[model samples]
Target: MDITLKSTLPGHQNPVFCVEKGYYADTFFTAGNDKGVVEWDIEHNAFKRILCAVSSSVYALRLIIGTPILAIALREGKLLFVDVEEQKLIASLQLGIKAIFALAHMSWKNELLAVGEAGTLHVIDLSTYQSIYEKRISTTTIRAIAIDEGLGRIALGDKDGQVYLLDSTDFHVITDLKLHNMPTTSLAFIHNKLLSGGRDAQLVISNPNQLHDNFSFVPHLFTVYGIYPHPEAPIFATVSRDKSLKFWSSDDFALLKNISREKMQDGHHLSVNAGAWSQNGQYFFSVSDDKLVKIWEIKKIDKLVANS
Candidate 1:
C-alpha cells in the first residue's frame, strides 16, 4: 500500500498539537498553539466552523460519543466543555495552574480522564460532571495516558521517562519502570502490552503477562509525539517532531512506510504532532507545526499478470 497526500488545509496560525475525528468520522476537529478549535468536514473538504477559542493553547481535543459535546484541554490548566453544534460553552473548570496535556473518556466507567503538568490524574464522572477521583502520579508533567479495558490497566507516562501502570478499578500502582533517559512522550496499548515512545527517540514494548521479554528500538530521529492504532486495520501510525508520519505492522512491529517531505513529494515542513484515522480505515488526517492539516490515503498497487 502506498500513502498519498490528499489535501492540505491551512488556517491555524501556530503549531497544531492534536487532531481528533468527530463522531461522524468524516468530520474532525483540531486545535493547538493557535488556541482555536476548528472542525473540518473531510468528506466535503470544507471548514465546518470554529468551535471555540480559548485564552491559551489548546493541547488536547476529545469528542464525547453520541453527543455534540467536546472536551477541550488547554495549556492554562482549563478544561472547557463546549457544545460544538451550538458554538457555545456549556461548562468549564480549572484543572490546575499547570497546563493540561491530555484528556480522554473512560467509556467503560463513564468518566472523563485528564492529566498534565499538575501531576494529578483527574477523573470526573460523566453523568454527574463531578470529580470522582484524583491521584498524584508524578511530580513532573504527565505527557500521555492509555487505558486497556480488557486488561483492566491504565498506563501513564511522565516527563521523567517513567511509566506508571495502575489498576483501572482502584487506581493503585501496579508497577513503575524507567524506560528512557528523556521524557516519555506517548503511550498505546495493543494486545495487553504497553507500547511507549519517548523524547529519547526510543520505542519500548512491555507486556504485563511476559515480564522478562521486553524489547526496545529507535523508531524516529526526534521525539515521538503520538502512537495510535487504525480504527479497523491491524496497523498503527506514529507522528513525530522528526517531521514525518510512519506506519507499522501491529503484529510484528515492522516498519511499513514513512511519509516525509524528504522522502515523499508531499510532507510537512515542520514537526508533525498528531494524526487520526477515519472510522472506516480509508483515510488519515494529520496536524503539524506548520499550521496545516493534511489528509492522506493508502492506495493499493495493482500488479500485471502474464500468461505463458
Candidate 2:
C-alpha cells in the first residue's frame, strides 16, 4: 500500500496531543500543549475556529455523540464541556488536585470518562453533565484511556505500567493487568481485544480476563507514542519515537507497512505524535512535533478496494 500526501495544514505552535474526527461533519478537532482547541475542515483544508480557552495545556479532546458538545481535558485537572456550534461553555468540572491526561466518551452509557495524573478516573453523565462516579487506582499518572461503548467497559492505563478494566455502569474495577515494563503511553480497543503501547517499546493485546503474564506482547525498537485502529479495516496504526509509523494487521499482528517522513519528500522534520483514520476509511491523517498535519490517501486498485 502506498500513501499519497494530500495536503499540509500548518499553524499550531506546539505539539498536538490529540486529534479527533467529527461524528457527522466533515470536520476534525485538535488540542495541544498550546492550551487551545482548533477545529478544521478537512474538505477545504482550513481551520474552522478555536473552541475555548484553557487554563493549562490541553491533553485530550473528544466530541460527544449526538451533540455539539466537545469535552476537553487540561493538564491542570479541569474538564470543560464546550458548545461547538454556539462556541460557548456548557460546563466545567474541576477534578481537584489531579492533573487530567486523557478523556474518552462512552456513547453506550452516554457518559464521559477522564483519567488524571494521579491515576484518578472520573465518569460524568452527558445528559446532566454531572460526575456520577470516581475512583483512584494505585498507579502513578494515568496516561491513556479507551472505552468499549458496545460492552459498556472502560480501560485505563497509567504511567506505572498498569491497565485497569472497569464496569462503566457502576465504575467498579473488573480486572487489572500490567501492560509494560515502563509507563504505558497509549491504549486502544478494536473488536473484543484491548491494545496497549508504552515507554518500554512494547505493544500487548489481551482480553479482560487475562492476567499480566497471559497477555501477548509485540516487540518493537522504540517507545510507542500512539496506537489507533483503522476505521473500517482489520488493521491498526502505531507511531513510535523511532520516527516511523507502522501498520499492522489485527488478525495476526503482521506488519503491513512502515511510513516515515524522511521516506516522503515532504515529510515533517520532527517526531510524529498523533494520528487518526478518516471516517470514510479512504484516508489517514497524522501530525508531528514540527507543527505540521499531513493527510494520506489510500491507493485504489482495479477492483476499487481501499486497502494497503
- Top candidate on lDDT is 1
lDDT of 1 by residue, 160-200 (tens): 99988888888888888888789998999876678998999
Write the residue-wise lDDT of candidate 2 on 202-251 in tens digits: 88887744434345565456778788887667778888776677778877
Q: Deviation in angstroms for 138 in model 1?
A: 0.5
TM-score for all predictions?
0.94, 0.90
Would you list the C-alpha lDDT of every candidate in the order shown? 0.84, 0.77
RMSD of each: 3.8, 2.6
- The parts of candidate 1 lying over 4 Å away from their true place are 209-212, 300-308
Clashing pairs in 1: none
